[model samples]
Target: MTSLTVDRPTTFDVHSPATGTVVGTYPSHDELAVEAAVDRAHGAATWWRTAGFAERARRLDRWRAEITRGRDELADLVHAEMGKPRSDAKLEIVMALEHLKWAARHAEKVLGPRSVTPSLLTLNHACRVEYRPFGVVGVIGPWNYPVFTPLSSISFALAAGNTVVFKPSEYSTGVGVWLADAFARAVPEHPVLQVVTGGGDTGAALCRSRVGKIGFTGSTETGKRVLAACAQRLTPVLMECGGKDALIVDADADLRAAADAALWGGMSNAGQTCLGVERVYVHTDVYDAFLTELLDQTRELRAGSGDAKIGPITMPKQLEVIRRHIDDAIARGGRALLGGLDAIEGQFVQPTILVDVPEDSAAVTEETFGPTLVVTRVATMDEAVERVNDSDYGLGATVFARRHGQAIADRIESGGTSINAFVAHATIPTLPLGGVGASGFGRVHGPDGLREFTYAKATTRQRFPSPLALTTFTRSAAIDSAVDRLVSVLHGRIG
Candidate 1:
């Protein structure tokens, strides 16, 4: 509802990728400033943790309402800062609101104390497990889908009763400030959410400041550094590194649907999505049909400054990566089905599609992080699944078979999958979103996300005295023998 004006001697200018004009300026937060923000968040966490889920949920719901009310202002900032279409920016905000609502509504149910079926050996004890807030959570977010990505961790952390200090990418600091500003309005008494604007040094400061946990969303290479830095304090971390996701089209799949989903998944937001579809594996039986339909859909889309289906690449430097991957694919026996190397003139990279790219080419192997898709024909779904699984990154996958979508998706080595569509899995709050291997670890939605920012505390209380107790030092040797006999009676068959 309001803008947060952060003051510091040092500042960084945010330039619009679409116009190459200065859009906004943000404080270049130093290590001390970052520490101060975390210190404030630490104090806030204590009060928030004791606020109980009911109170916290009320505040969260209020914040969500404010976000919905301020959608246009926030969406304009998102478009100016990240170069995403205003509509797409609003979608991100809506998705974030849904996630926030889900988190607030589910916190008590997901994190509260619950009776656990304790081991039979400890039947005399009443055992229960509960999740506790980790005091403070540090979030290092990405520029693409800034609102949705950062809040994926922030909302869940807050719902779990942890105060959060978020450092959004240098590009989207305004959006972060707006979100925190709205939060301040919702809960005026405590600084439950804070934002620090800066680059790498400030992020490192947050990691070393001993925040209870760190949630980072960025590149895998950078994620490794975040993980290593957190090891200084043994601080727990959850990483949502970008992924080189693929869309697989089985022989029986609806080719039109596959092409439609692939185009939207790969080209939306100018293909700046972490789980953006980078590769396509179509069964040979339908490979030609799928490719034809994909190109047809792509032809209807364009990347530009106006109301185009896509927008410019938010990160200017990524243009080089996009060009490299396209060049590598074309130079190494791949044919450009649609736009190719020349399509990228300025900040905008027109939708580019390649066919027959070598499996080892950078276009297929590495994360292009651009609006480009590499299509490869495969002999069968088996080959498609194997090729998709061979990548080091496993963030998300899409299977387009109506009949066998679930079966084929089950074999893909990714955190989540969408049947007949891509990117839809992200809207489901109950499905945990994260990646395997190089795509990074830890989740940011669902129950797994609620637990990501908390610590599990297990407790046991004596419900009744056991006939033969083993935990007591006062127990006799005959009692120990009796315990052994009980164990033997319960487990002798296994040994």
Candidate 2:
């Protein structure tokens, strides 16, 4: 007779995807732990909300300085945890810091109480509206961008006067702890920002807990599950999900510039970016030239651990998905101008460029979050716009045209469109970033992002008595008639 036994680990190990070495180990927090973190956040939120914008801004500035001083250390940690190039990790930190600064500097003017004009019918009353914090917010982050994506939500929520209980991706648990520790160095008074490290169960606990709002970044399928779990508690959620983003190259577009942007946008971060360029639609007139340039640029790129142009895929399981997409594309008659299935070498996926890919193929329609790109030829600019708009994902799009750049960008169906550039919207602090359709909804940057964690508080006060008071119990018939006449006079003009 034989017997077998299995044991579950209470503390899970985080391994570097590039090296297959354990980088850090963290406790897998259960539901109760998540609830406790939320409780602590609630207490912190009360003080944080009352601290006034000036005080919060001061503290945030200190936090920024702390991060700046420790930028290299943090970037190294990010690289170790998620397998991104140190330089790329540093860039994410820089962008995230910029967003933090913008949120701190603009919070008061954006969310502070402001007077609004009273309606004619309510002329005797003064009206004002303000955005109030939602107390404690729960943020479930992603691994692809361990720092930037989560900080985009966390900074805005904090600036809007809410404390955040962050559940960082299990793959990036170490980086999440580093972020919390950095904030503590700046503001040690309260646990204004905290991290709970774990996997799906931990995130589910955060969602089910009594947080004011939730900000989630992941795949559309996982986002749907998060939304469903939040539904049980009726918790409001801001979803930042997946994207099958596209880049269009017009006939008059600069072949060199478009090719350069496309190569970087598609291959950076190993093409794991939610807004990364997965599909490139080029006008038939210049398709060959653009392809030539893109291939030349892509060929010079290499994927490896230290000092490589492209880093290894952060999630091991994602390698299989990438391979599946590549195989499916080749089977569907797509020709690989660059690397194909062979590009996915262990954890490292070398840059791949595929041409003649069908619009309905998985590589084009689904999100192949790897260093792979599928370029398709279009008959005209109109055809390019139609094909880009036909995707299930509408997160972002880019248009490259000399004369009709703006017009082409305006016609693309996406949450944001970049003209003659790739992902320029994400770099700007004032622009909101999110997606539409299967890409998910709710923005996480700009003014809209600040308000996503708060609710509008509207107030009205009587400045003086109304001559025709209509709400009095002792209203006379003559006064009612006068009110009716006023309403008719105010709104009776025929169109």
Candidate 3:
């Protein structure tokens, strides 16, 4: 919660989490600079939206190719700044590319004008609905999955014909710059995309600026501050916040597959994922076997410097938070099957799995953005489902069951639920992705994502004169009686 400070002014240094070396330096921007960038973005949006969906699609296709052509460079920036493994970084970019492709290819079909059936009372009129651009959008991205998170909003906004001003996390400003620079190369005519680098000050400024919409990806606490700041201008915001997602295993589940998913889901990306599995609920029938397999598979995973399957924690300060959570779990009578409090060392925190952790303990209740999971046993699937839904944060959940996977998934309160797997549902382009309750409101993927950046406008055209012109002031008592008779004739039950 402490604010970012600096002894050196004018610019800030981005330190590598894996090694304390300075990876990059970016200009420390201020409110004035943010206003200017938003102004330029809005000006470009004037011409960009007019280009229509086809022209925008062509430009976006070129942008997508540019990203693909230099994917290595982009992925490297992510690894260097965020300390995620190169392969993991690549997966993030590839997933983002899928979203970009979907936004571009399907924008016209989902957002273009489409006719709707006229009501029986107004049959003489024709109605059509279309979506329009929101002009300028400001995207404040996170350090983890830098390219993927911000691009989720930027790609959709651009495909819907809106210009963007992006402010990536201070930890990954270089990646943000690279993305904007690539956008410029694709469309050289306009400043359709711009980057302003700084800490929270710059982001707060963007929220208060004249942008029509703001898309933010970060913690739930930060999301509230952003929302309150945007309220000054009444600017609509899209918030993708924190989550304490749960993975459930049933009695008849595939034990091997469930173990693999539990380990990967809980420990991947150093457990700094919003949809990471923080809690596990397994039926007591297979609890011992499942835990044996989970711990056995987890032994192969390591979090340390160089060539490790998992990398260092991206944010340096999260080390203490992780340490405290592990300690609290132990103090509350939890047994560490894999790792204990001593697991945290500087930027690296080894994978830790706790058993019998109390439900009210901080480790089980809070978003421990670390490589940890709290596993517990339940008597039945109903108890598992009830326990998972108990969290205030419900962004996503994974259900692993042979006979009741879909049924279990249907009852969860998150935006996206994967059956027998964790996070693969996101790969499907048509599934709307977001969260419910404290996880966040509004969606950011599929048809809903394309429409999220635009406003809907409905049009009603006169196809012919209406027989009962009830809207006109020139109507007589006889016309009113005729309308009443027509309504009665259409709906009267012959009793």
Candidate 4:
């Protein structure tokens, strides 16, 4: 594996958790090299933005074809690097390809020019708004859902005519490199998309680089630091941070369906997903039934290396955090219905289900980022909603209400909520994907994601002159008085 040198002797090793052997070693990039990469990206960005949407779309389409053709190879890389099941790896790649397709197909319509009404003050002028690409975008991706999360930013940015400099999580560097290689084959004329591999310092350097915008997806604490670094250069950023999302089950909910959805959402990818369901609230009347079904469904899950239902935790350090959360819950008088801390052996953390965990416990409040969930009971639907909304992170929520699904979903304080489903809303290409509060700001998956990488430029041209002309220094006080009178007449309220 290729490596970069830093001031200090820093190194990262990728190990096969299933086999307990070193897979690869990568070096940390020094500050100087990072600066050089940013400079190169600047020049490449100018060329990319000049290519226009038509050319860019063609390139993106070709890249999509490349990914589609090599889906198995890419899936294998994902499975080897992140330890997700082969099926799940394939799903991630498919989702990424879907995003690429959506971005290419809709870029022109979503970001094309639109007419805007010129206010009375500028009556003589016609106004139009269009999106202008940011020069270069710096993307810092996470390990969980490596392809899907990073491509969410990368594809949209490219569609919006912005170049991308991606730094994938150290755990998934190989996948990142493969993605860049595919893009290079699609658009060999310019280095519009490039990958920089390293650790935290490398990511920090990207934030401080001259990139026009930064898109980071990771922990909330790390997001804050990234925001601070970007602030130094006044570079805008889109932060997709940690999430402790909840699943709310109403009295009328289908317990079996809800249990199945929650199990897949919480335990898939070993619970490393940012929008993974961490906490579940069920109405007191049906809490026992829901708990029973959830526990039974989760207990059947197996985490291993070979063809299993789920794979081992990719980041070894996360194993300790998952163990800590299980330990804390067990210590706080919570009962582990299925697996516990002891279940976390090596990199495989057995699916865990905890009941009666205190609301104040770390498992409930903090992001476990593991295959464990806490199920709680609430007396009323209102109480369930309140509990789900009480957290600092509001990335996504799930509502399992047969009758009032949409109403309950709308009331939740989250970016996206799935009614009668878990994370199904995110698959819809039209709806935006992001979070509020501690889950961080900005979006990454829909028309909103495409616009995030561009700035709105309003242009005005004089089509015809109106009776009232007020934008020039030649305007008289009499005209201003007439305009004020018209404004008052239109908007004045009765006393």
**lDDT tens digits by residue: candidate 2, 354-379:** 98888898898899999998999999
Per-residue lDDT of candidate 4, residues 231-332 (tens digit): 999999999999999998999999999999999889998898889999999989899999888877776688887889788887777878898899999999
Clash pairs detected, candidate 3: none
What local lDDT score does residue 100 receive in model 2, on the 0 to 100 scale? 95
Q: Using TM-score as the measure, name the better of candidate 1 and candidate 2.
A: 1
Clashes of each: 0, 0, 0, 0
lDDT of each: 0.90, 0.90, 0.90, 0.87
- lDDT tens digits by residue: candidate 1, 142-225: 989889999999999999999989998998888898899999999999888988888898899889996999999999999989
Per-residue lDDT of candidate 3, residues 27-117 (tens digit): 7878877887887787788899999999998999899999999999988888899898888888888999889988999999999999999
Which prediction has more favorable lDDT, 1 or 4?
A: 1
TM-score of 2: 0.97
Global lDDT of model 3: 0.90
Question: In model 3, what lDDT does residue 286 have?
Answer: 98
Best-to-worst order by lDDT is: 2, 1, 3, 4
Stretches of model 1 off by over 4 angstroms after superposition = 1-8
Number of the top lDDT candidate: 2
